[model samples]
Target chain A: MVRVDGKGSGALVEIRSLDKKYRRGGEEIDVLRGLNLDVDAGEFIAFMGPSGSGKTTLLNLIGGLDTPTSGAVRIGGDEISRLSGRKLAAWRSRHIGFIFQMYNLIPVLTAFQNVQLPLLLTNLSKAERRKHVEAALDLVGLSDRMRHYPRQLSGGQEQRVAIARAIVADPTILLCDEPTGDLDRAAGDEILDIISRLSKEYKKTIFLVTHDPIAAKRAGTLLHLDKGTLLECTADGLFACKPEDAGK
Target chain B: MAIPLEYNVRSVFIRWPSTLVAVLGIAGTVAVFVVMLAMAQGFQAMLIGGGSRDNAIVLRGGADSEMMSAITLDQVRVIADAPGVARSASGDPLVSAEVVVVGAFPLLATGSDANVQIRGLSPIVLEVRPNARIVEGRFFQPGLTELVVGRNVSGTYAGFKLGSTVEFGGGRWTVVGVFDAGGSSYDSEVWCDAVVLNQVFKRPENIFQSATARLASPESFQAFKDAATSDPRLTVDVFRETAFYAEQSRMVSTIIRVLGFIVAIVMGVGAVFAALNTMYSAVASRSAEIATLKALGFSPASVVASFVAESTVIALAGGAVGVLASLPFNGFTTGTMNWSSFSYLAFAFRVTPEIVASGLVFSLLMGIVGGLPPALRAARLPIIVALREL
Candidate 1:
């Protein structure tokens, strides 16, 4: 998708000339090469590619979960390419919110506690954290379900709770790795609504990586990737298609 | 920092097999620990209980225990006037000069025989030891060639029962009574009159093996020591009854304590290895969960602490069970050879609070030591790789 509104000009995420490789049993396996991209604040974009296309590898690099062999990744002003271990954890907690396809909510915690996870890094009191969690759940319209556990919720409901968790810390960016990949169509739509609202209502910069074209179609800009390359930029606002797009 | 207990509990639930294996390993360690501690307790109790605080043992000037000492009748008479020696209201000496000997015999129980100490005592002896009781018969006529066997010395060999005759040192002695001496050293003694024993074992400088005297007060103790030691006429040493028993207690307790520590160390090492195995399994299995937690911003320290705490909980559970397992052994009486007496010394297993506490701390330490490596591995794992394990 081409930039239409030119609204989010300042970059929230910037990745340059990133490359990664692994040395296994005395052989080198290259995973990513010369990857370059930028996403400004409040933009929703999708990363689509084949298996091992390095969508996850690139996302891992951008999320500061892994260090790139070569490149710089700046998220909300901090270059996190060289941050190690606990420092990386600290940086990740403050800067990025991740929504996984399986919705990796800690099973031991209740929905409220799951949302409160990232905020544990903040200096907020329990009451303060609770208030923020309530607001986040409220924004996703799951305020009444704050006490439910992950196992107690339906797939869409769990995803919505995950979204609430992602936004609870008031993070700068939302990174979804195939967010709807694990759900049925109806539940996926409900999750997309919540995710779309995160961008539209809270102005969170969103990056969704997925291969299902219908899932990709929901994004404002689609960066179609086949072999780790940005092959196409579809010109459409996030799910800008008519209501019929939800069916197809 | 004291981690909230919920984290530990949740961690156990997440890694149940690892936790169970750790608990079971710790359980085995604890079981052995409890049994050993109980044995020590029983042995210690027997040794400590076998002595009296009011009665003092007077040994030859150079000797340590009655089994090794012999004193003349003159020394006994001299020690009776020692300042702390309690006197009867009838103006008689409250202490008794006794003859102690170990008669060799084959045992009926365990088929392992050892010498049994026989003491020749007088009228004042019963008054000095309140635990002395004639359970089966009246007191023996002291001047007669009659004898009484303490209950512990009875029923272990032929002619050991009440009214059974036995010949010792090629002399005939009639068993006239059986007594119970409330589980002290007196319980192990077969009794006869000093006059009768001196006549039978006659070299009749009227020598006895040792003297046991009752003291009246703490203040008069030094005077008694002076009476025994300062006078060249009395070649002997005097100790407070309490002090003497306390000394006797150390010989047995020190051995029990040292053996207990050695056993605990060995079992602790085994438990540590088990805990290490369980923790590694836990960390390996929960890598994805850990990665997710890391992604959620929990510090590696918190994660490490949670696992260690969980392992400790398992270990503590095992230790608690061990303490309980040891309880039945408490007061379970058994006897072993006392090298000093060349006789079977009886004792009960004691399961004390200090012992249990030390065991628990040991288990906890084992868990912590074992959990550390896996915890570090978990902490250092890349968040991406961990999450990918899901």
Candidate 2:
């Protein structure tokens, strides 16, 4: 019932009192509790937290991969949390791009084919789809390695392919869950540089979940989560109590 | 929207060992199914192929087969004289009064004794049965202890070649010729003169087992049937030769088909379980991949379709292998006891195109049935749970 007007209003993601709960046997464990946040267009935000602090859960809720227990997630003026299962999947395909810690490239598909997967859901012609896939792989600097399978690519190259797949559809928001978690320091830095360039040059809104402090430092805004709550950390310390509290 | 079919195909090849288990299991089932149906088909073809639409058989009333029918010489004459009977070049009716009896003979391949039909034929038998022709040597001379063996009989039994002597019924009968009946049931028989067989088997002087006559035309069958059944003095059953042989094949073919189907179904049960186990493991091992696809916004329907497509591909592969494995059995000769004639009948295995198609369709159905539960399980898995698996 409460909708946030995000499209043409310069806001890309808007969350309000979002809560996620999981029941293990009999006890209800709160994963995300009463979370409120607003991300503007073309901004990059990093989510940092200890284990079990609901960082990935909040990203999943925003991407429509998982629904919030009792809150609304609005992106580009669409209330995704209220959408049904099939509609939510379609919405996610059109609006969100996902990058996982493990690269998550389909092992059987070559880099080009994996990047072309999300586009298969569209009604694009084969040639048109190929054109888009090649452009995305070119952007990721893997144009020459398009035919190489995931097992044949290096860790950093595989991650680059994953990033190409994540952005091939040109989704409005890019959700990266520990994108640099599995890479070495040099490979991880290369990935961060690409993410930073995507946000600044391509005008893409990005939300990244990570444990690496260096990866978090590249984001324009950094937020820390503890015990299902969100806190903003500035250069001095974690000073902002909450986005709602700071607004009050 | 559906996923590209190539994705499922490549996945099947990527997991070759597990796919091989499902394929070979289904292959075993389809092979058993096809080979058994082929046996039944061969048996049916042997009997049905022996008959012609323009010929009619005469047997005693209430008799189920020629072996059970007894025709007196007077009755044979009356039937042969019927208005619709066709005549040969000599103007005599194209009729044969034949005696049928079973004789035990040793198989050349196994040396085990089996019952073979000994037929006593009148002179006009080749005229009545146009398909029966001597392929080697000559027909037996009348009034002598001479016999001609069918090609299948000579091939299957010991000591039945031309110039060889077979001891039976207290005498040695010399084989004078070999006959072929174009793959008909008569190819399993040994032929001799009616008078000689009567004397050898100690049958009555004026009695024979059955009589067959060629009709003037196939349309004359109704007139022939009416003439024979209306005679109060003669108690006889008349049938078109085709209908008679088809009746003879009913019980044996049914038994064979039922046996074949039972074996296939038993093996099919094992195949279904093997497929189930293979698919469940595939789902388990690929949970993370499935989760990734789900995260990429693929619907559960697409996931289910992909897995089902993979399963069907495996089953069709097995079906193809099964068809190839059963190919060697086609036209391979073997023998079984004909319950109607109370004798061993040799036939070849027939693997018709229809049988092959049915076997493949059967395997495809098995794949669909076997893949359903696992596909549903894959679809119903919570995305969060699957993502956490890895």
Candidate 3:
């Protein structure tokens, strides 16, 4: 078994004094303000907050899908927050996978083809690609349903397929936004269990944003946010604290 | 990396109604383009196919058509005896001094009167124009009020059937035969003895409209032209038969071609607009999907290419349908007034492979023009905003 050390000195994702702002009709709205984080490799961290708390924005910045207004996001020591446009896209494809609340699988593709999408960026031969896709689907326990399209699968199954697609390329990190927000309690539990297994068994670094406490409890560490500031969860209650204050 | 092409194809199928709208619009445009060009092709073929490079025609100088030319009998003889003129088995020069006139004929289909060409020629016409053959009956006998009508003229006009008599030129003439001229412009004329026609029409006794002669070989035409023109007695212009027919087809064919292009362009604009609207709607409906693809690391250029490819496939399918829709008109006979000859000329619609190819090329151009803006818009969509859209 691979050992997962949450406080390890080797940090895979490091964000320093990050800020993100949006302008709406001359109003500069600060979405993230002076946020700093360090997530070690193989750590599963979840952020829980109310609407407008900038959880998704922070997730976007870490995944290289968006540039911060200032400061830097470094993944494996490379400053990715400065990358823009096509360069950022290439970086994200190689290093990050995203799972949305709606299970955003391409409607036209079957589950196997959906999982095979990320592998196309690689130079793998067709046989090798097929092998990778099959393995990913089998890992998600959807081996019997490879040919099913998104419309044909239940919500839980679709989320599972999304998970399979996310990890098919073995990306450095998985960024999920409310991955089970659209599911029932039973299906949501199943999704969280699968995510937990991926974190524990496969040593995948995961950053998840969710409103449900049950979903947040699956992560190795839980952080809460209010008014664009992150707070660590403690046994007593959630309070504004630095990354070092966690596990105190 | 890009989305697989099959994704775009399946998306098109998933939204078939909008796809069909663009397809039918482009199909209609291509059909109009193909049919119009076919008309010009058919007309050009009719005139050009009748001409032979080894034959030459002599018309009065400055006269643009045979109907406007008048050659005196002396000039005709001089042209017949010109150097390089071919000789028949009987040692006679193979030349025909022909007279051209026009008479109104009642159309069998429309009952409206249309001007038909009446050509008066000598017996040597058979030697000079070897493509003309009597299909139903014998050729007209000389010095009688007998005439032969072309197959197209016989089929389109009333009272021109064999064994029938028609009143014209202040007298009645018998339709002795029906001749086919191998799809040439000659198929739109009536032929009778030149001497009888001049006498009946009250033209000067020794004057004919033109003289056509077979040269010893195609190479002899330049010598023949120099010799015929050097004589001070003859004020005439000379041309090889093929060159003359091409000149005759120039005006009408140009008009049809220009009009076809204009109509196709106007209709093509409409098609482009239709395609643009369809693609915009496609992008709008697939906004979240596009965002997902972007989030998955597909370059914006790939998305643009995917959409353009889909539009092109739709346009090509429409072009094929347009070409197929035009097949029924192929070889279908119709008649129009020849601008140069000032007489009715019958021809078939020709749908050549080149015409079909041009139609497809035109459709492809429309697809590109129509697909571009929407594709650009799709590529430039803000990923975060697009993802948030329902």
Candidate 4:
């Protein structure tokens, strides 16, 4: 786990005592109960936990992808949880860029058109959207593969193209849920390297959820969640709770 | 709003099979519509073309068609002497007392013959109908067992040519010539002399089928009909030639219109089903991708819009195909026998531009209606749950 330098600072994403649940017939399944978190601007924070530990759920709440049942999520200065459907959707589009496990590129479209999908929501010109897509593909080192379909590319290339799509809208905060979960070790390393560079070089805040220690180690801060709670002890630096020897 | 060309084009190409099915279904509907219009037109032609503006069919009172009316030979002679009735230059009244009856001749396909109207006409009937001419060997001799078969009969009934013989009620009528009625009701008949036909049928003194008269003036019709009906000795009615023809075609017209609507509705149902199937399959196949779009900064509304747009593109392609497929049917001619006239009729398919436009609009509506439900499903997906599945 990586360590953070500052102890107190303004957070780009702030979660306040969140509780979430799922209803299966008459019974309720509690996914996250009373989870709290804060992420600062330009920070690269990795969340690590075993399966069913609410790592991704917490990330989703921070990104405004899902609403918390009993608490609030504030991004920048706006309390997102309190926003209505339309307002919440507008906020999400302007603030967050999400990366999922498998690259969800439209199979029939070229990689360039896939990257241009999000920009369609904006009032950008045709030429302008093209320019932004080209620049985004260049950022992911896939400028030449713009016209290729998703099936024509390797797993790494596809993931890179997906990354290009995510960045095309120029979102302030990036949310990645198991971004490397479907890639090989080498491809996973390359993806981690690109994500790390986004936070440090581009000065964008990133909140990533992963089970891989190597991917988690690249973050400037580490958040360890278990049973819907942030552990009290920091591993070595920031929010790391790899209480390995201590728990043993 | 400008949509990306690739977005619309690729979406249609991806769903080609479902698209083709939808187009063909709609095309079948349009074809049905065209054929029905042709049939109605054919029936109308046979009825209207058969009537001569200068001539009229005087039936007995309280009756419509000839089969339901009864006129005595005395009344027929007295009506023929009326001042309104025209006369040939030979000074003879240009009128003929005709007998019309429905009889059956065995058909090749059905094994049992359908009821066909047989008319016994005179040379004066020919003079009244200028358009009715003998295109074959000759007109039947005035008084004999020989008869003239109409153009329609020659085409539909085998052995209905000159020198051929047909049996009716144990009496063999030899066909002497095949004549064309120039697309009139006469085309449905077998023409024999009225006196001989009445004698053969043993109804020499009475005839239910009325007299055909060449009128002096069209305006004299009301006076002529009033005089004849009030004669007490003659209870008969009169109608304008066009009005009579229009009424005759009414039943077949109604039938064709109803069939056309049924076909259109059925086609609509089929196209809607195709649209639903395509959309449902599209949602299932693109669930993961759509979820990813929803998760990534893209709002649920945008994701739904994207999918709806894709489906609409497919529908538009299908609609275009259907419209093109229906184009060739315009002006295509087909033949059928009119139910009221018992005459064979040929008419062209009246595929108007407006019907084609409606077909396309209907297809688009099907797309919108079918796409809405699937779009809602795409919008309702939870990002975290979707990512977990992936």
User: Worst 10-residue stretch by lDDT in candidate 2 chain B?
Assistant: B1-10
lDDT of 3 at A187: 95
**Which has the better TM-score: candidate 2, or candidate 3?**
3
lDDT of 2 by residue, B20-120 (tens): 99999999999999999999999999999899998999999999899789999999999989989999998999989989888999999899999999999
lDDT of 3: 0.88
Candidate order, DockQ descending: 3, 2, 1, 4
**Compared with the true structure, what per-residue lDDT tens digits does model 3 show for residues B1-390?**
567988988998998999999999999999999999999999999999789998999999999789789998888889988999999999999999999899999999999998899999988798898899999888999899898999999889988989999999997899999899999989999999999999999989899989999999999999999999999988899999999999999889899999999999999999999889988999999999988888888888888988898788888888889889988889989999998878999999999999999999999998899898999999999888898895
**Superior candidate under TM-score, 3 versus 4:** 3
After aligning candidate 4 to the native by TM-score, how far in Å is the CA of A205 from where it should be? 3.3
Q: Which CAPRI quality tier does the interface of model 2 achieve?
A: medium
Residues A44-78 of candidate 1 have per-residue lDDT tens digits of 88776678888888778778788988877777778
Error of 1 at B51 (Å): 3.1
What TM-score fits each model?
Answer: 0.85, 0.90, 0.91, 0.73
Candidate ranking (lDDT, best to worst): 3, 2, 1, 4
Ranking by TM-score: 3, 2, 1, 4
* Cα RMSD to the true fold for all candidates: 4.3, 3.8, 3.5, 6.3
| Local accuracy of candidate 4 as per-residue lDDT tens digits, A119-225 | 87688998999999999999999989998999999999998998888888999888887889999999999998999889888988888888777787777766777
lDDT against the true structure, each candidate: 0.75, 0.88, 0.88, 0.73
Model 4 preserves the real interface contacts to a fraction of: 0.50
